[model samples]
Target: MNNPAPGASAPPPAPAARRTIDIVNASLKRRYAREARFRFMGAAAVFLGLLFVGVLFGDIVAKGYTAFAQTYIQVPVYFDSATLDPDGSRDPQVLANADYLGLVKASLRTLFPQVTGRAQQRALYALISAGAPQQLQTMVRQYPSVLGTTRDVWLIAGADVDMLVKGQIDRELPEADRRIKDSTLTLVDQLKTEGRIEQRFNTGFFTNGTSREPELAGIAGALAGTFYTLALTLLLSFPIGVGAALYLQEFAPKNRWTDLIEVNINNLAAVPSIVFGLLGLAVFINVFGVPRSTPLVGALVLALMTLPTIIIASRAALQSVPPSIREAALGVGASPLQTQFHHVLPLALPGIMTGAIIGMARALGESAPLLMIGMIAFIVDIPQGITDSATVLPVQIYLWADSPERGFVERTSAAILVLLGFMVVMNLAAVLLRRRFERRW
Candidate 1:
């Protein structure tokens, strides 16, 4: 390495070190500007996402919060034995079959004696829900001694009357254009003046089942269906998904077969969810004869849909456990199974749980899958078990949204709010669980 010729003059002596602040190369400046732009764009995207979420939540809450209250009219329901139960025997079946409707009509007529004409009377009768009689029947059945007494009962008003009482219906609208007639609206106002019209917290919305009457419709059955479906989904998916993941990651030999399986699982995660509904219909319902419209079938379908997600997440978690941990455990006389079960698996649990919760949140909002298996049917009874006919909360929302009743609009929104609330709770719970189990090392 002969030194450069003296004429090279030492290549103009090496430039003195410059302060970083002074070294503002154009390329470096451009790169930094690009990074700043990227950060600004990312922040803007996040803000936009948060803004949309807030707006959506605000709209839902505003539309639905009113549904939690129901209007009622306090009317005297005289339990005339002749009108209600001609039979002296107090048989439950006979009592149920009694003319409770007549009693309600009589009570209403007694209050509005001025309402004459058949058409006017019919309109007046429309102010009270047909379900009111059923309410009275339940009341009397609960209090058998009230069979012979005249008692004041707070009865749910009809959809139109309920809307009017809640000020949702415009009384100034033309009688032809309004659901509640002017005469009926006047009577409702009269009842309001009498201190009998009241709005109460809708306990029945949480207690009773669905009904044909919008005023009587409740989400109890749908809530029960969701509970059973989710419980079954979690029970079946967690173990099966985790087991498959473990076998693939920890036990199975690396081969084309395993690779094919992994590919299929990843594909399944992106398949249209409704396709799974169709598969459930063809396989579980048609081929296997599983009862359609039951939570059991819904659970089975959801479990299948959730399996790929859980398996992928669990495998990733298991793989993330440092190989050093496996090597150290094996070097210390620990069996492979012990290494996984006692060490790696425990550390991976938080990730598995996080995935499971996200999967469940997806399942909870799924309606199309449940709809394919006959869960779209209008069910009035709360499901007693997984096999009982039922609809989930999302399906219920769909049903209510399709209903023609003005009241159902609010109900649909309310159900959506409830579903959203449940999702928020599940996400929060997942965060808590992850934090609780997180192992830094």
Candidate 2:
């Protein structure tokens, strides 16, 4: 190197080169350790979340699994002509009017002859469902020739007795502490020993409607209401959402009015669901005079709530289509409408459907809006149409959760399982549709 002049400053020292891997610096080691710790923390958080989900599902399955089966008793019913059909005509009307309650009580009395006092007899009769009369009526109508005959018939047990037989109500507890009395337990055990009581698949739980009696209650009405509401929601939301998205993304001028509308839609999507319920109450029920608790009102309300979500999703989907597609279509002399309908819309449909599914799923689980419109009421009859009195699955769950009966606890869990099942199916369908139709650019 040449020497510097007296007035000139010496060149600055050169920077140190990076050390080899064989001699790593302490700073590098610290950095690697920090990165490793961060990764572990992230993994731990994810594991904890999954573990919580597993615990929840396991608990629900444990509780609700028993609700799928019911206890039934085989009673020797003597269809005496005097009690069932005094006229001997076996007319269905006569059968409907007959005292089937007397026949059921008589059968139970014969089964336990030792119980004689009025109180004992009352307790014994309480083991069977009060709805047994209706069940007997159905049996008689199905086979009118069975009149004046003695035959064994399977009848449903009462909810308390059902719980005892299902092993839900503990026998070890003191008689006063338990819902089932010692006498009732003895009779249940005797019946079980004789193979007269058995657990069978509970078809009534699916086929019937809400009842004050838990054993007689079912989810058919709520299930039907959910279907009707969803049908209406999809019918109203999909086309309108898609149309609005197409216009805003492709056809509408970029102006303040359009910007304001976009902002409002975004804000609406974030609004609490109950707010929409209140809106529906004011507009559809109070102003338009639509019937309360009807699926029509429910769908209209859900449509308003779901509209913003669908519009946002559809706009995003429409925007994602490559500009090259539009250009190519227009280059071939296709008009704006033709370009959108024939080219862009077809490619964008998969994403649009995914958004629709999400919106529908959100609507399916919403109960607050429906509650505002009176859908939380107990509806015993399966709705024959959208305008009929009805409740949805979420509302059914809410009602059951509020019930004081021990049986409704299991029912509430079962309803939750059912609602989750529906959501899973909807999401799966969306995924399948996307995979089937999505094209690689």
Candidate 3:
């Protein structure tokens, strides 16, 4: 080492440590700057996602909110006993089969006797929905005394008139470009001026079934199918998924078979949902001969699709039960099965149920798989059992969306709102169930 100068302060040591700290300080500022940028980007991404979701919700609500009500025209019907029962016999079948539509037409003509030409009369008749006949029949059958009297009854208007009343059709557009011609528009306005045409809450929209005519179409069949499919799916998937999870997590010996199953379960969760539809097509529909387009087949397919999620969620819930709980149960002289079932299962039940419900919700929204099983068929009758022909809400929406009618457009949006509402309800249920039964330890 070099000798220090006599009596002089040692030459100032090279400022290495200080220089090193300066370097670090410079890089630290850059690092912090980068981190801030990253946070800003993350927040921006989240904000963009939420913005898009809000826009979508707003659009759906705006289009669908109007479908809850429909336009109707009050017609003075003279239900002549001669037209209903020519022989003067009060036969229910004869009354039921009478030309109720004819009565409605006669009433409209009486109201506008100047509408003489066939074309003008046809336009007048077109103002009323075909469902008016059914409505009249129902009314007459319920009250036999009305068969010979004149009564003003409100009847659902045709799709065109309903749209016009709802202001969905553009008035500024040329009459040639519009479905409602000038003559029809004049008739509609006259009726409106007379205080006979109006809008009311559409009961048939909820109570009726699918129809080629938009005004007569309803979601009752779809709702019933959804209920039946989900019920059967829950029944089949919950017990099977939970039981398998318990067996694998608590009792099964560690081996290659279990490892294979573990990998397969993971793989199945990622499998395209459409594959399950095809599997359902091959196995349930072809091999087992389950009725095509029935809720039974749909339930089987959805159960298969949901099994992986339930199994994974259940296993995770079971593992969450602390090992100490198992040791304590065993220490108290509990058998292995008893330790798992009596002690662990009760604590994990909420998670298992939540997982099952979420899986069912996913199954509820699925349409591709159902389409493969022929659930895309136009099912008009409400399903009463799992074996009955059915169409769920998603499929109903799909069918309606594909229709080339103005009325169906609103109905489609309304159906989507209903579906989103259901999914929200289900997810909320999961949260509530967890909060209700969660054991933090």
Segments of candidate 1 deviating more than 4 angstroms? 1-39
Off by over 4 Å in 2: 1-15, 18-24
The digit string of per-residue lDDT tens for model 3 on 335-407 reads 9999988989988888898889879989999999999999999978888888889999999999999999999
Judged by whole-model lDDT over C-alpha atoms, candidate 1 comes out at 0.88
lDDT of each: 0.88, 0.90, 0.90
lDDT of 2: 0.90
lDDT of 1 by residue, 262-314 (tens): 99999999888888999999999999999999999999999999999999999
- Please give the distance, in angstroms, between residue 119's alpha carbon in candidate 3 and its true position after superposition: 1.8
Tens digit of per-residue lDDT, candidate 2, span 85-179: 77787778888888899889999998888889998888899889988988988888898887888889889999999888878898888888999
Between candidates 1 and 2, the one scoring higher on TM-score is 2
**Candidate 3 minimal-lDDT segment of 10 residues:** 1-10
Write down the TM-score of every candidate.
0.92, 0.95, 0.94
